[model samples]
Target: MIEQSRLVTPVLGFAGFSGSGKTTLLEAVIPHLKSSGLRVGLMKHSHHDIEPDKPTKDSYRLRYAGSDQLLLATSKRHMLFFEYRDNEERDPQLRECLAQLDHSRLDIVLVEGFRNETLPKIEIHRPSYVKPTLFPHDPHIIAVAYDQKPDALDEFNLPSLDLNQPSDIAGFIKHWLANAPESEKYLAYELKL
Candidate 1:
């Protein structure tokens, strides 16, 4: 059997501070998208240094010995370990990471963080934080999720999703995916109402 690649995978982003339900929303949304028969890919961004391989492990030792990238695989799972070179000046761009995926097989890409990146995002806000809303000047903010009614803001026209009900939020995302222009390829696999 020959494998075919998908033409496009619309990227969706979620951004918020720690403990603001960003991961919670993703946990609910990913299963919903998969149950609808769409192959979903996820990418999480973190500013702190990450160690996927432990220091005492062989992979970690090999990496320290100077391998640029490491591929570890078992019968059921695989992981790619990448080490940045000292002379490397630039970091990978969001699109570059997206391009590295086998998009031909995926229906969508859900990203967490990268708030400053130019991409469509759903901002998760907590009323208690008392922070400024992201939609006022960010055209890329497609929606907002909040625990309570947000104070009136005239600059943004985007809809708001309730953070209390994960199902409702998932439903809203499903609706958006169904109506979005890039949804053509996955329309056939869309969930029936």
Candidate 2:
């Protein structure tokens, strides 16, 4: 069989400072999105390193022994592990990683981090915090989700939604994906407009 190319998945993100409800909102919205028949893929960035295989495990031993890449498979599922030989190898290009997903099988890719990337994002703002709002500075930020309307809410005039209500956020995402102008500019592969 021929290898399949990655899908040109539409991408969006939840951008917020720490302690904001980005993750919690996503957890709630996912079920709502799935209920509507959307196939969603997610990528959450972790500040620390993650080790899925333990040192005692055979896969880990094999990886340390010599293998550059390993795949553990069973009828239920398969996991591919790649070893980066150099400690310097970190933070790979986000687009290259996104391209690895089968985007054709997904309606959206809900990314949790890489907030600085150029993809369109929905800013999560809690009015209690004094920090600068991301929407004022980031053109890629298309909307703001807030717990309570902030003093500067009228400045940008961008669309606003209640962060406490995941259903409303889900509705916005569904509609945004369906009607976003020149949507392909934010796909896994940039489209020729």
**TM-scores, one per candidate:** 0.82, 0.85
Best by lDDT: 2
Compared with the true structure, what per-residue lDDT tens digits does model 2 show for residues 1-193?
Answer: 3334333667898898877778988999999999999999888876777789899999989999989889988899777776788878488567766765666678889988788888889898887876578887888888899988877768988889998889999999999988887553365343222
Backbone clashes for every candidate come to 2, 2
Model 1 clash pairs are 5-104, 6-104
* Candidate 2: residue pairs that collide: 7-103, 7-104
Q: After superposition, how far is residue 129 of candidate 1 from its true place, in Å?
A: 1.5
Total backbone clashes of candidate 2, pairs 3 or more residues apart or in separate chains: 2
Q: Put down candidate 1 lDDT per residue, 1-193, tens digits, no spaces.
A: 3233334577888977776778888897778778878798888877666787789999889998999878887899778877788875555567656655666677778889888877778889887887776777677778899987677543466788888777777777778777866643231212211
| 10 residues in a row with least lDDT, candidate 2 | 184-193
